[model samples]
Target: MSMAQRERQQLVEAMTAAGPEAPTLCGAWTVRDLAAHLVVRERRPDASPGIMLKPFAGYLDGVQTKTARKPFPELLEEVRTGPPWWSPLRPVDAIVNLTEMFVHHEDIRRGTPGWEPRELPAADENALWSFARRMGRRAYRRSPVTVVLATPDGKRAVVHSKPSGEVILTGKPSELLLHAFGRDEVRLETTGDPESVRAVLSLDRSV
Candidate 1:
């Protein structure tokens, strides 16, 4: 299988083993919900509907919104069908997907309250960095700040947000990416402020 496929495969293996009680990032979604979300979302965008957009009480969620999950077997069918939109075949989308995986893994890891952080694939990690470096400078992310990523393993990247100000952030690049991707509860040292980092991450998910 290709690197991207392998990465997704690894994610499936790790998450499938998580018990129903295991927490996923989407606020109260068990690991099962997370798997289902990934699987259902990977299908044509048309698969979901207005029910996804309806308002509700506690835990109201969009169909393919960030934290939904599905059965492990269902995700396997998506694999047999094809890759999700955010995948290597789409290059940029691949990075986007990696960011999702990394962040969501934290969701599961933290929700469980005592599990270890699952190590992401090196290539996926690198792809996310490359994409972040580029996307950070787009008209959308334009800010006068320098975002530095220092991963636990020492992977590093320096991205400057121009025209805003010189802001600096440093941490395990993956950790930063996860925090930036809205997994929540990720702690990182900041030269500017986490609010700024939080803004960037929010945009990454929303836009």
Candidate 2:
């Protein structure tokens, strides 16, 4: 299966194993709340603008809250079955949902005790790296100094370039993606001038 499909299936399975009440790393969201978010994001496009636009957030929250009130089984079924036939996301699932699924899967997996990082296939790591590179600027846009993404083996990309200085964040592709997405559970090394590193670290990189 494609990485996106694999991750989506795995996320559903993880959600099933964890049950509705399980906590996720997504702030105060429970597994049920995350499920409702996934459902509303794909199925309720009219409300999805709130995901990135603050003005629509209240409307989006209203829709998501209502969706969460559905029976947990039905909510999960929607997430497992994928988007509806007419939804635009159906045709671009891999391009769009890969990171969304992977990160949220980790959110659930790592939020619980006894979790460990998975050894992902090299191709999956490459995919995450590509996505991270593309997202570099937007992810680190608020940083006061230049931000650099580096893999353990030395692959590097500049996120926010500044003449002043840069902070290098080193980790595996998956870990870098996690950190870029504002997840604190990832294992990564931040290096650079101490002052610049602190500035980068203090910046919120969440979507």
Candidate 3:
């Protein structure tokens, strides 16, 4: 299997083992919801399953098969087959799909005990951070926050406004990433009126 495929397998295994009560990064979803989310791909020929999944269409225009009693191997096979039957989605459609698959998989693992997915290469982690950062541009402008990250691990992330200087925010990259992604700690971490950090978070935390 390719590295991506291997990673995909790990993702499936993690979700399957997650059972019902496991916590996912998406506070709204349980591990089971995440498994279901992973299994059901979309039928968008133009867009990949990740794109469809990202908007959380899984709950919106979603369908669940009566596979409750089915073996996990069978359930995973259904996901492997792709979902022209459910909706239109392109497989490996874009970076968004890969990133979603990567991040949410981590969410599932983060929620569960003894289910840690691989630590992810620093390069890979940085890449995802970079992607999110790039996508974060326009949204950050509207908010009044600037964020900078400093870490004991020597990893840092700096997100700030360019001209307006409304909000200034910074912290560890991972912390910043987590905060950007709807972490409760982030909300409690409001530093100043430059609530723009939270504003940026509110706007872009969807993924």
The lDDT of each candidate is 0.54, 0.91, 0.51
On TM-score, the stronger of 1 and 2 is 2
After TM-score superposition, the amount by which residue 3's alpha carbon in candidate 1 deviates from its true location, in angstroms, is 3.9
Q: Per-residue alpha-carbon lDDT of model 3 for 1-207, expressed as tens digits?
A: 433454566677776677665678776776665555555444333323443456644443344333223465666665555444445334543443555555565676666545433555675556556654554453344454554443435554455545443443454344455555544343123344545545655655444
Q: Could you tell which candidate, 1 or 3, scores higher by lDDT?
A: 1
What lDDT tens digits, residue by residue, belong to model 2 across residues 67-152?
A: 99999999989998888999999999988999999999999999987888999988899889998887777889988888889997
Q: Which stretches of candidate 1 lie over 4 Å from their true place?
A: 48-96, 115-124, 134-165, 193-207
Candidate 1, position 14, lDDT: 60
Per-residue error at 108 for model 1, in Å? 2.1
Give the lowest summed-lDDT range of ten residues in model 1. 50-59
CA lDDT of 124 in candidate 1? 56
| C-alpha lDDT (0 to 100) for residue 19 of candidate 2 | 97
Model 1 — TM-score against the truth?
0.59
Off by over 4 Å in 3: 1-6, 43-72, 80-94, 112-118, 138-142, 148-178, 184-204
> Which sections of candidate 2 miss by over 4 Å?
none
Instruction: For residues 1-207, write the lDDT of model 1, one tens digit per residue.
Output: 554455566566667667655667676667767766655545534443332453431233454443345445665456444455564334453434555555555566667665555565676566666655554344235443555555556666565534554445455555555555545466566565666655544444322
Which candidate model has the greater lDDT, 1 or 2? 2
lDDT at residue 53 of model 2 (Cα atoms): 99
